[model samples]
Target: MPAAHHPDLELDDIQAGALAERPSPYVGKYLLLRITDRADGRELVRRLHRIATASRTSERTDDTTLTVAFSYHGLEALGVPQTSLDSFAPEFREGMAARAAVLGDVGESSPEHWEAPLGSTDVHVAIAALSPDAARLEAAAEQARRAHAELPGLEVVWRQDCYQLVTGRTSFGFRDGIGQPAVEGSGRPSTNPREPSLKAGEIILGYPDETGELPPMPMPEVLGRNGTYVVFRKLHTKVAAYRNYLRDRASNREDEELLGAKMVGRWQSGAPLVLAPDRDDPELGADPQRNNDFLYAEDARGFKCPVGAHARRANPRDSLYQDGSVDVRLHRMIRRGTSYGPMLPPGELEDDGEDRGIIFVFAGAHLKRQFEFVKTQWLNDGIFIGAPEERDPLVGPNDESSGFTIPQRPIRRKLQNLPPFVVTRGGEYLFAPGLNAMRWLSELDT
Candidate 1:
């Protein structure tokens, strides 16, 4: 195998949110907007164009970034040509809500049960601002406010403020934002030495993906090049319930932590089971060079990292490649998550009734293949791993009937009567256009 030839990416025009690794200890905000007038929407785009940070830049002393995206209805509301609108990926055109069933959003997770303005047609625009501190975050927010503040035609319908928990982990107590793939031309290096750089087209449009072909882009090169689909999902975690479940299943305190690590495939300290199979290694977990460096080839039976564990099912790296029927690389997508609400007090077993979880952000070119495929085939179901009755132990919409199996020495250990630990509050699929596309949209003739 040869090293991939990196493309001359248009970093200056690409949104920083698409490629830039989020800074740790960060504060951010997510805003959902409804576009009432086409002219005002276009004006909003024009204003945001000036503030949306580019992927490659040296002007900022403070690490603050602004990103703007439009939903399918948003493009139409902004008066985008019908032909162009029809040319986008069908999954993006139909919107995430329309495909809820495929994403396992049944029962309480269904769109009808979703939060207001999230899955509705009223959600036209989605803007996100992220920074390392409160002051920088506020500065970015003000810029976004100015973009649509005076525009009576554009109304801010919903806002959710998110930040890194003091423990620098998700509400469930695992270090996250790890295992992000390196985009070939993005200049960011992969944390895992075993992982190869993904083709730029896998994330941004108009570039060759893993298939060695340019993915289908929306009509008109200017509107599609350097752009990508963004998937935003709000998940609510039942921290107290999760803690209680582990406590009930384990023999003692050490076994309780081990059970959690088995489910997540990584200890709370971020140490992977593949590397530190017997114990949690905080030192190894903190070292970026070693934490994400292992593959699942030797653990084909998943004794080290359970096949149905949340992290393993989410990536699976080389585990599925042996069968030749599946290629994990095709489904790979960049995932970024930020915790919202306050963390529950440690070791508390009772429900606090406070809202807290993670806001998941995904960036990729192929929505159906990348994001949706993983959600449907990998996490929600376990057929690919030969465990049809199982789902991801942590985030999957598990029920009393759902069970998780851990490969062990004498025999397999099955944990049954699993309860749903996470619920989908809301979600949206938006198109993040490049700077040139932003300009093209701003100059569109309604």
Candidate 2:
């Protein structure tokens, strides 16, 4: 397979493999730095100006390249007119042109517009090291933290969240990071041996319209585009709350192990419920060929996996694929998140207290089309599989009026009585830009 290339960015073997490693892409030691106020925006630009002009030019470090995906807040706070901000901020454009005269061989600039909610103004900054180095990452994070402190208008919402290939927990607690779409032309044999030649937009965005275009944007403009919409969520799972719920649901025959498997859709090992419904299939989970191959076809109608199973609703494998011909690729998202806080204490299983959960990060072309749509329409909405009483049993919101319930079916046995397991704490939306765009922003005037 050839390498997947955008006009401004490239996904080489290393990058693509890292991205395809798990359910989520590998974001490395990156921080979702947010700037909330206009005054902070001005101060930020001023410091960037000083750094750009005074700092001696040096070879790029594993930590040197900082890519950002700014929300409209950053742009509006910077006072970018709506007309020019989409194409290129006029001030940034001019600054780049002036810098080009002094800094020869500066890379070409390619800016793309992304969809935003009607009244959003928060800017998202995604800063990552070009290469992974612990010391450098610490320094970079410190620099970002200090920068935030210096600017009175900006407030750091979430801090020090790492991006991983797989999101830590399923509804069940197995190592659930495996099988993702291979970037087209990346020299990687598709995990699904049958589907060899997949298109870029299929996984990145939904299928194009009659003209083969994505909604709200031209195909050329969206295809190979650098910026992708990312939803960042802080989910706080009450370990005690979850454990007590499991214990209450477990009848005389069911054990703690069985109960945990049902809740997470897998066991401590990374097996799937569809394959090893009765027990943990460590061998199957380890096998690359068999792990991601099962579809919710038999499971779709609630025969094999439940209607609200995490993996089932997440991709649905072949369940939603019409005729096994039409690819429901748009539903896919690159989940690049990591687990935060510490493991739950042994005796605290019954305590109704605070505990941490996964920091959810999903990236795709359109928020409405991909991330939000999945959360609102399928995951949180139990109607996808025609089950009025089921939502994503694990992450589904708790509201009796809304008809969502967490069913506790032990291992292979079908039991309907269960309660909610996960709860939302806080979250936000962000955008991630390419390397060149970050440099351009630095040179711009406030």
Candidate 3:
């Protein structure tokens, strides 16, 4: 046991420390935020120029935290250096000092615990684009590779393209980038709030002591921080496989729109099929006030949208409310990913060849409580919440070998008869450091 900084104080110190760390050339796009000490609804935005200049060829993407999570990648061509553990020694000390100052603590804090080398599975780099042109994808892929290589000690864990031969969109299809959570007061809540208030220690470290404090470490020592768990996974979708599966089993009266509703659990318009069962409701999907307003209780047993559908499993809504109180707040994930590779070639589409998928990014306070638990217990496991079924038909993994399976059923078919359809390819876990953490690295003593 050691002296640790208060959680509130740690937040600001973490940001300042990361800013001190030089921006890596491999970093393409990033979103950084400093939480307000109070709820005045104000945010501290770090000036990009103050840290590092963007490469001339760099394409920057950022937004308010709630609209979309932060995402970063350097094109393999960027020639960024890989940062090593030795490169981050000195900055670790400064970060601890910054943390102590923010918390108003008086003592020599140690940084050894936070300065250790990140695990191999904790980082990932992926590439995706519009069409199937190897030249185009290769350029992006190379940029990511070079960026990782330049960072002396940071490891690049996994990489893959979306599965497109079967569908027109990325592996998961249904025009992803939907269902993202919106930060409080940013506007209307686009996505539910995952946690009521920010819990700094829980996010950066595995778990804090009962007193809600993190152990103190020398500004440059890497102790107490043994392992940082990261989950990396590449999901490949058979878009064509999904479409054909739907069309073949669709009743003459059920059009393609209806078929998509059943498969995706929502229409392309973002409307949940469970509410607009018989038709595609563009109005509902577009209405900020009405879009996320339905409960699975409408169909109780998942008659409107199958319990095995991706949307249903990803967010159970009222289904999980034991006392008729819908609390979907905990299951939310901040997805900070991008599309990789190119769209399928026109000829390849006809031949049922591979296309592309997405580099799915899910980060939360606790890996086991948030992302891992959701995937293993709910998404991948068939019998979630005590149901007789296996798992979400679209994203559920059948076994380690076969990947995923999409269950099929007649338009009016009972829940028991559906066959499996979707599949998984490859993936890994990664740690998205806050701006403060980045700065702390740049100033570390070699």
Compute the lDDT of residue 245 as modeled in candidate 2.
63
Q: Write the per-residue lDDT of candidate 2 for residues 94-182, one digit (tens) a residue.
A: 32123222212112111111112211233345443322444555655565556556676765543444443243443224564555556
Encode model 1's per-residue lDDT on 1-446: one tens digit a residue. Answer: 21122366788878888898777889999999999988999999998887774323657756678888999999999989999999999989898899998899988889999999888899999999999999989988988998898899999999999998545698899999778899998888889989999989899988889999789998788899889999999999999999999999999999999999999999999999999999999998878888999999999998899988999999999988886988899999999989999899888899988999999999999999999999989999989989888998888989879999999999988999899999999999999998889988989996
Q: Whole-model lDDT, candidate 2?
A: 0.49
Off by over 4 Å in 2: 1-9, 12-67, 84-172, 185-198, 202-211, 214-224, 252-256, 287-289, 298-301, 322-327, 346-348, 400-418, 443-446
Computed on alpha carbons, the lDDT of every model, listed in order, comes to: 0.89, 0.49, 0.40
Where's the lowest-lDDT run of ten residues in candidate 3?
A: 63-72
Query: After aligning candidate 2 to the native by TM-score, how far in Å is the CA of 437 from where it should be?
Result: 2.7
Best by lDDT: 1
For candidate 1, give the lDDT.
0.89
Residue-pair clashes, model 3: 90
- Residues 25-60 of candidate 3: C-alpha lDDT, one tens digit per residue: 111222112121211111111122122223211353
From the highest TM-score down, the ranking of the candidates is: 1, 2, 3
Question: What TM-score does candidate 3 get on C-alpha atoms?
Answer: 0.56
Positional deviation of residue 8's Cα in model 1 after best superposition, in angstroms:
1.8
Compared to the true structure, candidate 2 yields what TM-score? 0.69
Worst 10 residues of 2 by lDDT: 105-114
